[model samples]
Target: MLRKIAGIIFVAGEEGVTLNELAALLNLSPTEIKPMIEEVQQTLKDHPLSPIDLVQFGERFLYVTQADLDPLIKNFAQSPLQQKLSRPAIETLAIVAYRQPITRMTIDEIRGVSSQAMLQKLVSRDLIKEVGKLEAPGRPILYGVTDYFLNYFALSSLEDLPPIEDLALNSQTASEELFSLKRWEINLFDQEE
Candidate 1:
């Protein structure tokens, strides 16, 4: 199955393919095929000598040459996956992801700071968007993570997210230490709702 996936990716070339396509082709759901796709990705990465690499950009998986072997190719462009989110943006994104369909006011309340700019930035980046209006006074807009969010983090779905309890710090100091991380790999989960 891994070999088949590799072959399909190799043949797909720069056009690449999507998990949905793979699942459909294999007569499986995206959840059923995601692990196999990950296995194929891991196999490619485990071999240091292999010049190829598999990367997920949004919803598409493209075959890219290893950076170490870039010189071998005539002209190798950079991958869009190289794009990164800021720490605050990541934090804001995490809040929305975990407690999705939440209002900006709610996010601001949780973060203990105004999330207006962060919300705007996230919306502009297509990472998060207004899902609907809350059925309350003023009808504040609710925010939720987009499909691009899952792809950016290489997550198959919200189901793939770890449990919040696993990441919760018992002490305030420990929580500060965790949040102070310079570069987060986005192993985020839910918070108390």
Candidate 2:
């Protein structure tokens, strides 16, 4: 039962699993779930070879890789180049960070290009994730920065991000200028051809 509970929490990922939710899923009461979680935690603690640990956040429990294994994991998980975010990924991240709980359609509109691959990369990196779904139309998934994002950037909260007005003004002005220049160059090239 403990192993099954741990497996459910592991598969839950960043979303986490609440005590009540787990109890309902496992066909047990919340009282029964608590001891199972403790048993799981004790089992993992006793087994130093286990790579994962169970943690509670609010009313939820999550399985996270043991912090002691960071160095070993980093050594094997990423190459030097892969450690850095690509330009498009950074841009997508910035957009999500500023305009959180936003949908892919909104991100594409802001970027003026498809950001599907970048979004997937960010999700895989645990930088951003699906926070919820929009109510309109097909109910597109809404993306938001993760707790890992805050920790990685050393931000206390989303409010710690630089004021969005300044960023928006600068970004909009620069993109408009770049777009006009690109359009002019394309027209000139077409005329020459």
Candidate 3:
């Protein structure tokens, strides 16, 4: 039961599993799963391999870096960030972020190549999402940067985005805006909405 609970917790990652959900997956009642998880929590107390503890945030739970690991985390954060996307993916993301609610054809026209794969990857990363279908023939999906994208970039709102006129005027290549969703971003996305 402890192993099962731990597996569920790990796979859930920042998106935590509810007690009811865990119980259903384990084929046990919530009452049963609750106490079993309590036992597992106790076992993790003062654990040496991983000092991090499980945290219950209302209906959700997650394991975060222990305070002792702060310096390591800080160093990791200080290092230059890496790109999760290819050049094409970065280009695709910028177009979507700036010209949001834009159709895929528009992105393709700007890039001069089929962007189907890049669009798929952006959607998979939750950086971009299909806001709705466009009014055009075939009603192609309209894409926009997700709340996850906005938070990842540390922008408070869409209004924080630079004007579209600036982007069009600059003709700057679009590599400047690629960012992976950070752990905190994932956590925020996971909370009940």
Q: Pick the candidate with the highest TM-score.
A: 1
The local lDDT score (0 to 100) that residue 152 gets in candidate 3 is: 74
lDDT of 2 by residue, 1-193 (tens): 8778988998999999999999999999999999999999888878969998788989989877799888988876663324556666777887898789899999999999999998997887778999999989898999999997786667999998766565457675643432333221211112224
Q: Over the full model, what C-alpha lDDT does candidate 1 score relative to the true structure?
A: 0.75
Structure candidate 2, residue pairs in collision: none
Estimate every model's Cα lDDT from 0 to 1. Answer: 0.75, 0.79, 0.75
Q: Write the residue-wise lDDT of candidate 1 on 48-132 in tens digits.
A: 7777889998888889887777774633223222335567777887789888989999999988999998888778767888899
Clashing pairs in 3: none
Q: Is candidate 2 or candidate 3 better by TM-score?
A: 2
Give me candidate 1's TM-score against the actual structure: 0.47
Query: Candidate 3 on 1-193: residue-level lDDT in tens?
Result: 7998988898999988889999889999999988887877777776789766777889977677787889988886543232245667777887787778899899999889999998987787778998999887899999999887887768998788766665455555323323222211243233235
Model 1 ranges with Cα > 4 A deviation: 1-84, 169-193
Query: How far out, in Å, is residue 71 in model 1?
Result: 32
Candidate 1 weakest ten by summed lDDT: 184-193
Q: Candidate 2, 51: how far from true, in Å?
A: 29
